[model samples]
Target: MPLLFLNEKSWGTACDPARAERAMADFVDAVRAAAAADGPGTALVSEVDVKALEIAEGYPVNKWIGVSPRHRVLWQRLRGLQGRSPVRSVFPTENAADHLEYRHDGEVVLGLGAAHFMDGIAVSLPVARQWQADSVALERGELVEDDDGTLDMRHDTVVVRHLSAEPHLDGHLEWIRKTRSEGVTTGPRIWDSRADLYPHLTFLPRVEGQLGSLNPHWVLSVRRALERLEEAVAAWDPATMAEPEWRTKVSPEGETRKRVCRFTDLDGETRTFDLHARFTPGAGRIHFRLVPEEHTIRLAHIGGKIRPDL
Candidate 1:
């Protein structure tokens, strides 16, 4: 039998007590209905321990039991567990193999443990694993990225970008969805590669504007690029700073333009770091002082779809 309830630690809007009590009332109604149909035959009714709550989150189920009409009336009149006072009690432990449906932000995200959801945002996951996995930890300033693309650096010191707002790193999917068919890659070109790339994070061009998320890996990669870029910019000489050609004359009509690299560092400092000098045609090579950390730092070269300076 399935149980309809909230996690012990799950709270919303700073866990308003009055609001939580009302929600618990509805939850009890839902629970009793589910329990009536699943009674005795199913173990799900007793599987959840609402008392196992974190005190810090404000909504302690043990204390809030009297708020729910169903639990309140039952406890007031002495129900099954009413005689049993609030104390450490033993309950049958669930099998490790038992599958549980855990959801957050209203969407059924795969994984284990209880979590909090609100305002279309999933906040925390209260997971206590028996087995340990390899872990790594370091200071916030210790982490760095290579240079290649634009990025938004938040307060996520040791961030798991893949598990968070991923689309922020994968560029604006909305823009792509709205303008999905604009073939900027190829039709007639004198270049050997395409400009339309997959490795991009879509951000509003303005300082204070709307934003979205993307594939997490894409964001991590962009952060790596930023690391290299920071190094590249630091190593730049003042004399060679103005040499980067932001424009190139391809023809009398069609000129080859370049992209500007932008970034917001962890300190909330925003900077436009120049990468490379010139894509001077017939210089025998695409010789620019661009961030030479690695090609993996590129947004235009995503999915191997775009190649530059051929």
Candidate 2:
């Protein structure tokens, strides 16, 4: 027998578990109306109340419903439903937050927390049939962008030659690897100068004075030097540090030459690092150091000449 449901407007037939589903559906509709009205004093759905109802109804929470993160209640509910689902690929958001967009094939199955669900309402069905359609298109080799705006194509698989035990450290390294692979010449520079003092060790200038005065070839040199530094760090081994062959040290010895830097690691331990130089024709030189304990490399400085003070 179909269950009868009574709301403020009308009565309707809600069969068995569909009663809960229908109630949720109505809640979504109310949220949508409130958002669209854009009027003062509009009441939005309470996440706590929605969660309680979902728990009471025993509904699957993490289903991939084509909604954006702006629909907080609906988005979180879908996340809960699809939390355990297998994902084929993961993509980072533009803001570089820890939360990532998880995709199955070319369709987004999860990670919509950074998206705008209400924006897709005009084209998307109330129940997320559009996402199913996208999945089919993906299977057909069609390209699409996921809800969080990440390209849905299968990225070239990167087999990490060296893996870090620390998840956060590994994530930071992966970000650098991906940035290098994509040939991203401009973006936020890693500010670890306080960790070690080689001077301002960055490829791109963060200040107004650095905008145009930088030499083009020098920029390329710094970039390539950084890439090589990343590769070397990826393959570094602490156990073999005693071997001279394993340690590739460059020249220019004196008070003006390379120096050791000491900094505290994420674990709150002080570690010492030795600087090495990589020269680029017409672009001067770049100084960097490998910290084996942290499983990462740090760019120390870039300059026309080595400063004795440093």
Candidate 3:
């Protein structure tokens, strides 16, 4: 959960722990119902949600996608969160929305800036790429938007990352209840996949916008991207998911601006990944296909792959 966890502190008194828990439960129940519903609100976004849920047991579908953020509105309905800080804010001398971030037993383990939890997991992102606002800083006046202005990150700025996967609600609630429970306090623009579809820098929204408008076509393209991502995940051996780290290396080759990376799997199998950038969406931003798949780091990047090896 990077952002979109409304900080309960922002809600002042309305941010009750028990109430928040109740709200979380309610939100999840609503989502499950909504997932089953076929009318209205079931647009492009719903398509993504329902499809992922449908495939929950089929593949790597139930790892929690982007549902956490959607349920934020649900909690607001249950408990009218307070927004106006009794004190002055860094940017808005006045606070606006009243939302509970998230908590477990009592303490604020993690406050969802704009997220809701169902089952034991939370969603991280939307592979479909709607250019929505993802987050905004709580203490700091940092605005983290998506490629498009569809989301209002100004308010969805509370969240946590790197949480240990909790098998059940009891564990998750404990994590949220403890202020110091596997905590990763952060500011805006941070990228820690403890939760989310991918590792997105807080500035991803801004960066994506510079590329171009995010329309259905772009979203559909993102669907393609997800397909690629899923393919990678599927092809990835579970051993790679656990221990035996895998690595990829990319390098530029002459005029081709080539990139070469290799996947070093747990089985000691190395799959050479090489790509030549033939296009870029914005200026020098390279946007091209890959020999194996459209996922490459850079002409010469030894760090994380330009795209996840999967």
Instruction: Report the number of the highest-lDDT candidate.
Output: 2
Give the best candidate by TM-score. Answer: 2
Residues forming the 10-long window of minimal summed lDDT in candidate 3:
277-286
Off by over 4 Å in 1: 1-13, 45-48, 54-56, 66-71, 74-310
State each model's CA lDDT, in order.
0.27, 0.31, 0.27
Clash tally, candidates in order: 21, 7, 33
Instruction: For candidate 1, give the lDDT.
Output: 0.27
Better of 1 and 2 by lDDT: 2
Report the lDDT of model 3 for residue 2: 15
What lDDT tens digits, residue by residue, belong to model 2 across residues 258-309? Answer: 2433334434655433354543332244444454555555443454444345
27: Cα error in model 3, Å: 11
Name the regions of candidate 2 deviating beyond 4 angstroms.
Answer: 1-183, 186-214, 242-252, 255-274
Measured against the true structure, the TM-scores of the candidates, in listed sequence, are 0.24, 0.28, 0.20
| Cα RMSD for candidates in order | 19.1, 17.8, 19.1
In angstroms, what RMSD does candidate 3 have relative to the true structure?
19.1
Question: At residue 164, what lDDT does model 2 achieve?
Answer: 9
